[model samples]
Target: MIFETERLIVREWRDTPDDLDRVFEIYRHDEVTRWIGMEEPLKSPDEARTVMTRWQARYEKNEHKYGPWAMEIKASGIVAGTVLLGPLPEPSDGSEGRGEIEVGWHLHPDSWGHGYATEAARGALELAFGRYEVPEVYAVAYPTNERSIAVMQRLGMSPRGLTTRWYGREAQCYVTLPRQRAASN
Candidate 1:
């Protein structure tokens, strides 16, 4: 496992049939996919497998320092969804790299309203600030994504307003420092 919270185990995605099926189950929903990526739900098992392959490649390329990881419930051993800790894509405009890291989550709709996103994200922040010693972490979401915004607030991230920097489209940004996290606790 990459890390553990009181109720979740964050770990690497496996290549098993069950894992692939779980990946499909989570991403096939439009409700879950609307706020992330291309805003398109995976339409088939093949597409889900392809996505899993791409994520696995990213995991290998980053040497596990960063990637979208599987969030497994400790009680049922059910894979809920993904929590990502990675370098945000560079701004669309010409600029030097800022080495900005981001923390974000995407969970199945069934996992909603259960505090799992916040718990898993707290653990991801702990990994970022404690083991990785990253000075700061940011989260960006569509301006209308109130659920994610709420999670950011709960984690003590301060709003930085909107920007087209990372994903080449305007996104509401929030950032947090190690010190801010301590104060929030």
Candidate 2:
């Protein structure tokens, strides 16, 4: 496991059937998938398995400090979402990408509005700054995603404006550095 909060446990994504099913459920919802880079909700469980297997393989390398994680609620042992603390995917142009660590999350709609996203993100950011010692971490969302924007603000990230570099579509970017994490620290 990467870390834990009072109400959540953050761990690497697994390739097991149960994890694949949960990942599929989380990524298959339109509300969750729309703002994510996916062109549409994943087509099937097979697709979720493929993605989860890839993450398992990457984590198996044992070189990455962080990557996509499964967010499990402490009281229920239910995975309510997926969280990420890692380098943003390199841009297709082969140019230098944002070159910063990133923090991101997508929770099941049923788990929304309960502060789970914010709580789990706080734990991830702690790892990013405390363990990983990254200078800065970023977050991006579709311009219209008010929920994630609010989370960014709660995390003390400053608005860095918009960009299309990561996903080839306009995305509002926000950033936070170790200095800004003082309050959260």
Candidate 3:
């Protein structure tokens, strides 16, 4: 599941052979773990390694089929962050037939505002539409996260409604209609 965008590579998962310290380095980065939810941000590289290990196991089981993809920047070849897609059974409120896949992204804070989120997201959108036969894509973000909301807007997506149950709090729900609009443009 390696998808190459114009400037990034979205892959399933990879276990780098970096040193012990480096394994924790990305974890210890506050900016990197900001949007991630945990009782506390990652405290050390070991902790991050454990989390990534779990991700690896999940991918081994093909659990990520409807979830996130690792976002790697082509220029740096470094794993910057990840883009998430939602259609999973857990969080979904039985909305599979709704014709949409919830989209999300989390870039290291350093990668913020660099178009990486949008680029990687576009790739996910392409996959969702092209491969999944998904008729539409959607996203939900805290209303205050102006950047994510902006990226959704830039993707030609618009809000269908707002809901508080999404992330355990209110969020703006954005949606992109069927692909027919692509031809209208």
Best by TM-score: 1
Worst 10 residues of 2 by lDDT: 91-100
Q: In angstroms, give how far residue 20 of model 2 lies from its true place.
A: 1.5
Assess each prediction's global lDDT (C-alpha) against the native: 0.91, 0.86, 0.68
Q: Write the per-residue lDDT of candidate 3 for residues 71-132, one digit (tens) a residue.
A: 77889877677787756323334333443467888766667778988888887777777777
Give lDDT tens digits, candidate 2, residues 50-139: 888788777766475777888999999889998888888787545687667889999989899989988988888889888888889999
TM-score of 2: 0.92
For candidate 1, lDDT tens digit of each residue in 20-42?
99999999998888889656898
Q: Which regions of candidate 1 deviate over 4 angstroms?
A: none
lDDT of 1 at 164: 79
- Candidate 1 local Cα displacement, residue 83, angstroms: 0.4
Better of 1 and 3 by TM-score: 1
- Residue pairs in clash, model 2: none
